[model samples]
Target chain A: MRGRLRRGLLLLVLVGYAAIVVLAAWRHEIRPGWLDAPGAVARGLLAWAGIPPGVAVFTADSASAAEAKIVDLCLEVRVVEADGRVVRLHPDAGERCPAPQPRIWVKGEEIWLDRSAVSLRAAVAARRQELRRGQSARATRLLAEALAAHFRARAHAEGLAPERYALLWAESRVDTNTGERSERDVALMRWGPVGEGDLRVSWRPDASLLESHWPALETP
Target chain B: MSDGSSSYTGQGVLERWLLGPVSLQVMVLNRIVLGGVLFLHAASRAFELPRLYGEAGATWSPAYRAWVDAVLAPDLAAPLLALVAALAELSPEMREVVVIGLYTVLLGSSLAFASGLFTRGAGVVAVVLHMLFVTIHPFAHYGWASLVSPLVLYVVLSRAGDHLSIDAWRRRRRGLAPLPAEAPAWPMRLLQIHIAAMYFHTGFARIDDPLWLEGQALFEALARTLFTRFTFELHVWSPLLVLLTWAVFLLEPLAAIFLWVPRLRTLCALALIAMHVVLEILTNVGWWNFIMIAGLLAFLPPPWVARALPGPVPASR
Candidate 1:
């Protein structure tokens, strides 16, 4: 009787664990409403324990939509000296700004980005959604200010005096519908006379102010 | 209650398969490979902790904080938010120092875990620290990093250090006989189940998607500048990309099942490894392919692993 009880308990535990795994997998794939409570429990337990509950990998849904929509995103930064000289930060040859680059020195040759930059892009995009109605100018100014602050911090970390020069940050979105591939720059933020004081942002500045240095995408 | 008969014969078939004695070699391989992968991942981010997690960085935004709170459970999110709030009170220099200090401990513990010296303790520390860092700025992580914690936890729960470890070596030096090569197979079995579930979910989730079904998923992914390694005229190579996409579509769900069959295990493992290798070459996903390859090592036959690895011969079953 003792042996039988022990075996029964072991079987019960195994079955319980298996059920959890299967449930987690089912919730991840199917996402049925009835499973929400159990799924939440499973996700909470997994997150608390730092265990992966096994989710779907990349399905390229968003990327596919981006391609089909012909949307192009490029981030540009320019440093404007007090003497009226503007210096653009160029990405390495054969690479685009804001995309991850391979850091060969790291073990396993991992690809890396500032990551904070990517986060900033996401934050800007989310903020854009809220400011979409009539607050476009305000949204543009906010994006520019955020970009300027992030870049300033990066400069400080690299031992550069960010206050010594004004920073110009802008984003260019290509109008692929025009057939001629005309690009327009939305000058987000212009922080000048580099200082710790409140930044004066000018939104919807002249598009010609910031020259696009990014290479044009070749049509297939 | 002691019987002269072999104890293995008394158990049911399911019990025998799940709880039966198996060589500890597979577990040891898992511990080492997973540990090494963790170490490499941590080491790659060593210089960027300040920028990635500091107050002045992009992660400090109010929007991101709200996003984190929404994604994590309330119980888990509260402490993480509290910790971030506490860190917010620190000076910039001090915050950088604290972040670097935590990262150093994580890196060291990962090395120790991989080396199998104080394996369980080191593994726990590594997993906790990794999870903390991942939670703080999850945008920096990918699917590969998500898989690390559970895999390491499985390793820690097993008797992975029973053999082929510094602890085992020290025991032998103290005149203790080396442990038997065989141990309960449940932990490894659980790991196998986890991998299968992962494949099953990823595979079936794409089944009805028009992009994947029409073989345009890979093409679209490659066309995106963010993920692809090079700029090329992909339209010319669309046919080849479609073939690869279909290959993944078929093999993924099939491998999830065949991986359980003794005769088909090696074939599935090899096919999966080949797919990962191809992905590594075509894209710049960080450490994902390598981590998957490390997990695939568990599915390899014990005798094959024992022969390839340099160690005392595992006793025959």
Candidate 2:
């Protein structure tokens, strides 16, 4: 009787675990609209247990979405010193300030700053889309502030003392059919005085400050 | 009792198939490969730990803070916030020390797990630490957290350290006999089923999408500047791209089914491996193709694995 009970319990546990795995795959990968409520509950439970269910739809990018347009976003930073001297920080300015590279020999080989830049650009683009749909622009502003804080932390790490830092968000668009490319500086975000968290965002940034890095930004 | 064939029916067959004794060699191989891959993945991120997770990073960014506030339940958020508050209370230097210390321990655990030193304990610690990091910054590491976490958990549950491990070697050195080279088959069965489910879902989910159905998905992926490793004038090779896309469309779902067939198992596994290899060459997906290939190795017959491995052969069931 004891042996039978033990086997029964083990079988029950195995069945329960299998059910959970199957349900997770169904909820996350299959993602049926009717199962949204159950999916959310499952996600909540998993998150509560500190297990991320992972990304839904692996390698499932929409080709239509990719073909729609190509947008390349870049970040440009300038440091203002207390003595009225301005120092421009290049994205490729050595190990201290690294930016995302278009081509890498292997995936996941980029440094932390480059990865962070990729995340920031993606977040900004998502927030911008939501803003265009009449949603609140708070998220976009929050992302800008996050970028400011990141650069501030990076500057501090590099032992740079600056009165203020100006951040410019630039965009490069490629006409796929005609093979023509254009570039413009879109917005600016500022963070100041080296140790504080004050951030300001402006939609109209100085276009003249946008460097002629079009060839560098080309897709090929 | 004249013939055991009478016993192989209904639930008994399934019970025997799943819970029956099997060589632990495959599990041991899986544990080593999975653990090593995980270690490398973690080590790859080690260089930028301070910049990514420390006082100098977005770990405390307002967006992350807001996400924690909105996404996590109050019960879950409170303790996490309290811990963060405690960390914040530390001096900048002290905080960095704490962050680096935890990261170092995480790396150590992954290495220990791979080396099969205190296998279960190390595996558990590795999974927990990896999950903690993933929970804190889900955006930074993509796909890998979800794919590897459960596999590690399964490895921890299995008796993978029964052979080819330091634990086993130490037992012999201590004048004790080695444990049996076989364990219950449930863990391997679980891995196979889970992988099949993944392929089934991913493949079938694309059925409704016109891009995939029309064979333009690969074309679009290759043309995209964000994902593709290099630019190709995709129009020139549109026909080949479409053929490959259809091949993937059919192979994925079919493999999910045919992998279970004894005669076709090796063929299915090889085809899937080839697909992953092609994907790795064409795209910038990190460790995904490699992880899938590692999982696919489980589908190869135990006899084949035993043949490939060196040393004295264990008797088959």
Going through the candidates in order, their DockQ values are: 0.06, 0.06
True contacts kept of 1: 0.07
**Deviation (Å) of B77 in candidate 2:** 11
Cα lDDT tens digits, model 1, B194-305, are 8887787777756665556777567655543334565454656878999998999899888778888989999999899999998888887777887677677778777777
Assess each prediction's global lDDT (C-alpha) against the native: 0.60, 0.60
| Interface RMSD for each of the candidates | 16.1, 15.6
Error of 1 at A100 (Å): 33
Write the residue-wise lDDT of candidate 1 on A76-127 in tens digits: 4455544544454433311322233221111111111233213344324433
Native A-B contacts reproduced, model 2: 0.07
Candidate 1 error regions (>4 Å) = A1-7, A27-220, B1-11, B70-94, B313-317
Lowest lDDT block of 10, candidate 2 chain B: B69-78
* Alpha carbon deviation, residue A71, candidate 1 (Å): 22
**Per-residue alpha-carbon lDDT of candidate 2 for residues A5-114, written as tens digits (9 for 90 to 100):** 66557667877777666665552334444434654665577659765332111111222222222234455556667676665544243322123432111112121233
Which portions of model 2 miss their true places by more than 4 Å? A27-220, B1-6, B67-92, B307-317
